[model samples]
Target: MTMYSTDTPVNGQDQEVPPFGTAPIPGSRGEEKRAHLQARRTEDRADRREAAEERRRDREHKRRMKTEAKNAKVGLALQKKAERQKLRAKRRKERAGRLVELREKLSHHMPLWGLPVVLVSLAVGASGQADAALAAGMGWASGGVPILTEGMTLTLAGLTAQAIEQRRPHGWLMRATWATATGAAAINAAGHYIAGVEDGADKALYRAVLYAGASMLGLVLWWIVMRSKRAAISGRSAEETTRWKRLARRHPVLVRRARRVVDNTGLSLPEAYAMVWQRANGAAPGEPSIREIRASRRAAFKRTQAEAWDGRTRFSRTAPAPAVVVPAAVEPEPETVPELASEAAPELIPAPYLPVALAVPGLDGQWIAHRVPVHPLPAWRPCQEPGSETATTRFPQGQEPLPDPSPDASEDEDGTQPDEAQEQVREQVADDRLDKARALVEQAALEGRNLRRHPSNRQMARHLGCRPGTAREYLTQVLAERGIRR
Candidate 1:
C-alpha cells in the first residue's frame, strides 16, 4: 500500500522524510531531537515534583516547630504554677507549725487548762442546789437563782481575766468577782443547811460546810490560776521582784512617791523608782548641780571683769602723755571791745561733787572700789572775743583736753564711711550665718534628722544659739536652696 511522506521542518531545521506507519531511524536528527525534548520534559517534571515535596516538607516542619514551642510555653506556665502552689503550701505548713508550737506552749500551763473543769463542776453543783432551794420557796419563778448567783460570779471572773490579759486595771472587777463568789458560797451553804435541817443539826452543819467548801474551792482554784496568769504575763524576774520588795520595805515613802509618779506619768515601776531616787538624792556624782553651775558662771564673770580691769590698767600705764599746747603771745589789736555788764559777770558755780564708784587695781590684782568726784557738768567759762590770746582757751588747769579727730581718718581707701563699713560687716555676718545654716542642714541630713519638724528646729536653735523661729527660717532657706520641699 502506498504511504504518505512525513517530512517536516522542526524548529527551522530540515529533517528526513519517513513513511507513515514506520518508525524513524535510530540516531536520526528527528529522533535525537524528540528524545532530547522528552528527557528535558521529564527532568522538569521531576524537578517540579521535588520542589512541591520540599515545600510540603517545609510547611510541616514549621507547623511542628510552632506546636513544640506552644507545648513548651504551656509546660513552663504549669511549672511556674506548681512552684507558686508549692510556695503557698510551704507557708501554710510553716503557719500550722507555729500554731502547733504556740498551742503546746499554752498547754504547758496546767492550771490554765484544769481550772475551768473544776470551776464548771463546782458551779453546776452549787447552781443546782441553789435553784432547788429557791424553787422550794419561790417555785419555778426562782429558776433564775442559779443564773444570778453562779452566772454573775463566772461573768465577773471572766471579765477580770480579760482585763488582766489586756493589761488593764481591773481592781473593781476583781473585787466584784470575789464578792459574788462569797455570796454564792453563802447561798449554797444556806440552801444545804435548810435542806438538811430535818435530818439532824450535826448533819445539817456538815452538809452546809461541805456545800460551802465546794462553792469556795472553785474560786480558790480560779484565784490561783489568775495569779499564775498575771505573774506569767508580767514577765518580771524574781530578782527584780525581790529588789522592789526590798526597796518598798526600806523606803516606803520613796516607793509611794514612785507609785504616784507612775500613775501620773504612765511610766513603768523601775523607771519611776529611778526618777524618784534620783530626785531624792539630788544630782548624781560627777554631774554639776544648779548651784555649782551658778557659781561657775559667777566666777567666769569675775574673771572676765578682772581681765578687763587689768587690760585697762596696762593701757593707762603704757599710753603716751598728751602734748600740752602753749598759746603763742600775739599782740592784741587796738580795737574797741565790749565790756561785760555787772549782771553778765561770769559766776564760777562749783561743780557738783557726785560720788562715783571707781574700780582701782590693787597690789594683788584685785579690784577695790573708791568713791571720787565725777561731776556731770563742767565749770562755767566767760565768753572770749575772736582771735584773743587767752591761757584758758589753749589749756585748762588740772585737765587735759582731748585732741580733735581728723575727718579723713575714719574713711577707708574706697571712701566707705563707718556706716557703710558697718553695713558691709553686717552683710558678711549674714552670709556667714547662711553658710553655717547650710552646714548644719547637711549634718542633720547625715544624721537622719529633718529640721522641718518643730522638735528638730528647737534642737537646731540650741546648736546655733538662735531662736527657734530664726532657726526655722534658716532651715527653710537652706531646704529651698537645695530644691527640697517642706
Candidate 2:
C-alpha cells in the first residue's frame, strides 16, 4: 500500500514530490509477476514430462526386442524337439522293417525245420513197431544220434545263460515241442488208420481223427515239458519240470546225453567225419547256429591255407579248349602288313617256386622277385624281447641275445672286428656313466634342493641319462635324507 502527499518532502526539497514508494514488483505490480513465475515453472515441468515420455518409449522398444529374442529361442527349441521326434520315428520304422524281413526269412526256413520234426516223429513211432526202419533213419539223420555235438551244446548253453541273466522269453523250445507233438499225432493217426479192422471204414476214420488229435496233444505235452523245465531253472512257474542233468542221471547211462546240435558242415564225403563228432553232445531248440560259426571258422581256416600256399598253391583253374582247324595264311604287301616279331622273345620260364612260370614275369622286365614270408607278430601278444623262450622247437638255440646296436659305422674298423668290441666298451661306459650322473644329483640334492621347487626338473634329468620323473624321484630321496622341506 503506497500513499503520496503533496506537502511531503522526499529526497530533498518537497516540491510536492511523489510519495517515496518502493518500485512495484516487475510484472506482479498487479499479479503478472506471479503469473510469469508460474508460467516458467509450468514450461519446465512440461519439458521434463516430455523427456520422461521419450525415455519410457526407449525402454519399451528395448523390452519388445528382448521379448522377440526370447520367443525366437523358444521356437528354435520346439523345432529341434520336433526334428528329434521325427528321427526317432524313422528309426523305429527301420527297425520294424528289419524285423519283418527276418521273420520272412524264418518262414522260408520253416520247411527245412519241418523235415527234422517229421522224421523224428516217424522214428519215434517206428521204435515200437518198425525198429529196423527207425534205426536206419536215425543213423542216417543223426549219424546214430545227435549232431554238432560239443560246439552246438556250448553255444546253446551260452544262449540259455544269457537269456536267464537278461530275463526274457524264448519261443524256440516252445515252437519245437509244438511241431514235434503235431507231427507225432499225425503219424500215429495215419498208422492206425492204415491198419484197418473189420469195422474198417469207421475204425479208419476214428483212428485218423484220434491220431491227429493225439499228435497235436503230444506236441502240447512236449511244450509243457520244456517250458516247465525252463521255468524251474529260471525260478519261474509253469509246471513241475526236472533238469536235464537229473533226468540223465536217472536214465540209463548209455541213453543219457546233452541235447545241443549246431552244424554247418558242407555236404561232402569228408564232412562225414564231422558228423561223427556231432552225436556225442547236446540238443538245442532248432537248427543250430553252426552255419554262422562255421563260416567264421572257414575264413580263418582259409587264411591258414593261404599262408601255407605261398607261390606253390594259388592257381586259377582253366578249362581245356576244344581243337580247331587252321588254314594256311597268304602273304600281304610290305607297306600294309604288320608282323609280330616274336623271334627275339624268349619263352616264359617259371621260377623254381612258381606254380606257373612266365618269361615276362611281372609288369616290367622279368625282375628277380623273391617271395619272402613275413610272419606277422601275433596280434594278441606283445613283442617278445630278448632272452624270452620261443614257442617253436627248432628255433635258434639258447636265449636269443639282445641286439647290440653300434652308434653308426662310426667305428674305425682298422681291418679288425671293431663293431663287436666297441659295443662291449659302450656297455661298460654306460655302467660307469650312471655313477657319474649320480654324483652330480647327489651334490645338488645335498643342498636341500628340489628341481620341482626350482625352475625345471627336466634340467636335472638331462644331467642324468634317465627320465625327468626318475630324476624327481632321486632328488626327492635325497631331500628325504637331508630332512628338509624343500
Top-TM-score structure, candidate number: 1
Per-residue lDDT tens digits for candidate 2, residues 161-250, read 345335454446344434444444544455556555446789777866754553343234333444444555556323212333333464
The Cα local distance difference test for each model comes to 0.68, 0.47
What's the CA RMSD of model 2 in angstroms? 30.9
Cα-based TM-score, every candidate: 0.35, 0.22
Clash tally, candidates in order? 0, 14
Error of 1 at 227 (Å): 1.7
RMSD of each: 29.4, 30.9
Q: Estimate, for each residue in 373-465, the C-alpha lDDT of model 1 and write its tens digit.
A: 323433335674353232322221343433333345576699877556545655665566578778878887788765465335655665666
Q: Give the TM-score of candidate 2.
A: 0.22
> Residue 252 CA error for candidate 2 (Å)?
33
